[model samples]
Target: MQVAVINRSHHPLPAYQTEHAAGLDVRANLDAAVTLAPLERALIPTGLYLEIPPGYEAQVRPRSGLAYKHGIGIVNSPGTIDADYRGEVKVLLVNLSNEPFVVQDGERIAQLVFARHETVQWQQVAELSETGRGAGGYGSTGTR
Candidate 1:
């Protein structure tokens, strides 16, 4: 699947780190470092503009290493970039730890995963079909 993209950042285009990697690492495009205090969030730009296919979407997700090491994560996990969007790709980053997190220019902050999605049509049914565990949710099953 080929996607049309425009790169205006100093760093190279986002790419898969491994052969079997599902998401591509996206970098932060900034003139100077941006510090995020604990529990603070900021919208960091990537300087990337993409043209996704009609049946697909670009999912912006947090990097596991950053989350585990620095308590850095995306405010809106797995943010959806619609196919019709034609603006710069920005990430909503948040600091979950007590210390402030500094985001440097060209730093890998998020991962982009392109996924296929389906548009569903409402059937306007009278009732939904019954299941084995109907209406049972929120820890209905035991942890053990």
Candidate 2:
């Protein structure tokens, strides 16, 4: 689980925990500032780069405190970072509040979690087995 981080600005790299950690902290770029108006979206630089091994992916997620308090959240919640991508890690933030939102440097913008997955192959079939609740969606069952 080796990740390469690029310090674009003079700011130090954000701290990371490896032992039963809840989330990977993503910090805002101190060099570049961000301002998002109501319902506006902005691509925020994290001033970090990552190197993920094959068969694994880094999922970018929004912080609950930031989203609930400031009305700011990741535009693409749980954005996927492919294993083979050797690009800088960036976050897309959207301000859902009524007023403008200012993003300062070193601010905890989001959280990233690394997960491993397997690529499954799909097979064509003429007919599929039906289940008891086949095609039931969106609260179709009784909410007990």
lDDT of 1 by residue, 1-144 (tens): 999999999899999999999999999999999999999999999999999999999999999999999999999899999999999999999999999999999999999999999999879989999997788889986643
Candidate 2 local lDDT, 61-134, one digit each (tens): 99888999999999888999998887778889999999899999888898888899999999999998999888
Reference-based lDDT, residue 93, model 2: 94
Instruction: Point to the candidate with the largest lDDT.
Output: 1
Candidate 1's C-alpha runs over 4 A off are none
- Candidate 2: list runs displaced more than 4 Å: 16-20, 30-32
How does each model score on lDDT?
0.97, 0.83
lDDT of 2 at 126: 100
Model 2 deviation from native, Cα RMSD in Å = 2.1
Q: Please count the clashing residue pairs in each candidate, in the order shown.
A: 0, 0
Per-prediction TM-score, please? 0.97, 0.88
